[model samples]
Target: MQIMSNENAHSETDLRAEGVRVTRQRLAILHVLREASDHPRAEDILTRARLQDPSVSQATVYRTLAMLEKAGTVLRNEFDGAGARYELADRHHHDHLIDLDTGVVVEFQSPRIEQLQAEIAAELGYEIEWHRLELYGRKAT
Candidate 1:
């Protein structure tokens, strides 16, 4: 997947466009998420937002994150089996491979898989709405 520059980072306008209320706490959370390459959990957001604004609280960050996810401004995935990790939602969609040994996540896209899903849905006489396929494995050394 392509990476975006931090300069094109998130702002209150983006949150508003997503129909999310523009709050100081929410904007802070979005800013941190936009800068993240790896998906982060609520705790990660709490820590970074706190560093940016001392008044920001963990509860506020969690609430804002949930709101952002609902608004499609961010995506959530459970990678480490602890809690879901959060990333800024963009135009592209990709699957994740998790490293069981170290709990690392790698994102990849496969056109074949996408086509297969469509074919499978057609064979079953059902329409696919959305799907998430996560493959968990250890790094082959």
Candidate 2:
């Protein structure tokens, strides 16, 4: 995933395009997501939003996240035994490699892997509509 720059961020416009009303609380949540390179959970987002505006509540943060997810403006990733993590959904398609020890996520793309997936689906007489690939591993020592 690419880090969104302040000048190029499209959270506000994306929300409006999705017919969602733009509010301060929602904007604060979006700001937190846009500025974060690491995918953060809803609670983490709530903490950052509260720091930005003390009046912001956990309910509001969760509600906004759901709205964003519905609108395809954010992606919610749920790793094994770990709570969901949120990131902006505007980047190109990529797969994740999760660090099992530390819960860190690394995004990568491989043409060979993509081709093999297509070939396997074809061999099974199925056309792929969508797929998610997540590999769990530890960092090289």
Candidate 3:
């Protein structure tokens, strides 16, 4: 299963805050990402963008996504060797549980995991700056 936050979904305002210029193609791409619940690949964004504006092209989606990711408004993840998937970066911090067979990404947060990471980091003489955790498995039958 995939969980996504629709609240404060990426908007033109976010782009402007990052000093990104709002254009038609970029808006189409951002709109697609805004409406998505699951991590979508560049191809998925391109397909969705084209639905709203026939002029949206594959290259534009890729470029726009790259620009957004660089601007810290989008996150890109690749779990279990799957291709890159994108989501809005403004969401609360959470790790991913990826279903290997179906390619589903489930988001979750655990205080215990955070505490463990902090303890481990302290043991190694370093304060945790950031981290990304991914667990891969299939549905239990």
What are the per-residue Cα lDDT tens digits for candidate 1 across 8-33? 35667766776777877776787888
| lDDT (Cα, tens digit) per residue for candidate 2, span 64-89 | 99988998888999977589998888
Instruction: Tell me the lDDT of candidate 3.
Output: 0.84
The lDDT ranking, best first, is: 3, 2, 1
Better of 1 and 3 by TM-score: 3
Q: Rank the candidates by TM-score, best first.
A: 3, 2, 1
Tens-digit lDDT track for model 3 on 15-87?
7987999999888888888788788889888888899998998878888888888999889997766689998
Regions of model 1 farther than 4 Å from truth: 1-11
On a 0 to 1 TM-score scale, where does candidate 1 land against the true structure? 0.86
Worst 10 residues of 2 by lDDT: 1-10
lDDT of 1 at 124: 100
Segments of candidate 2 deviating more than 4 angstroms: 1-8
TM-score for all predictions? 0.86, 0.88, 0.92
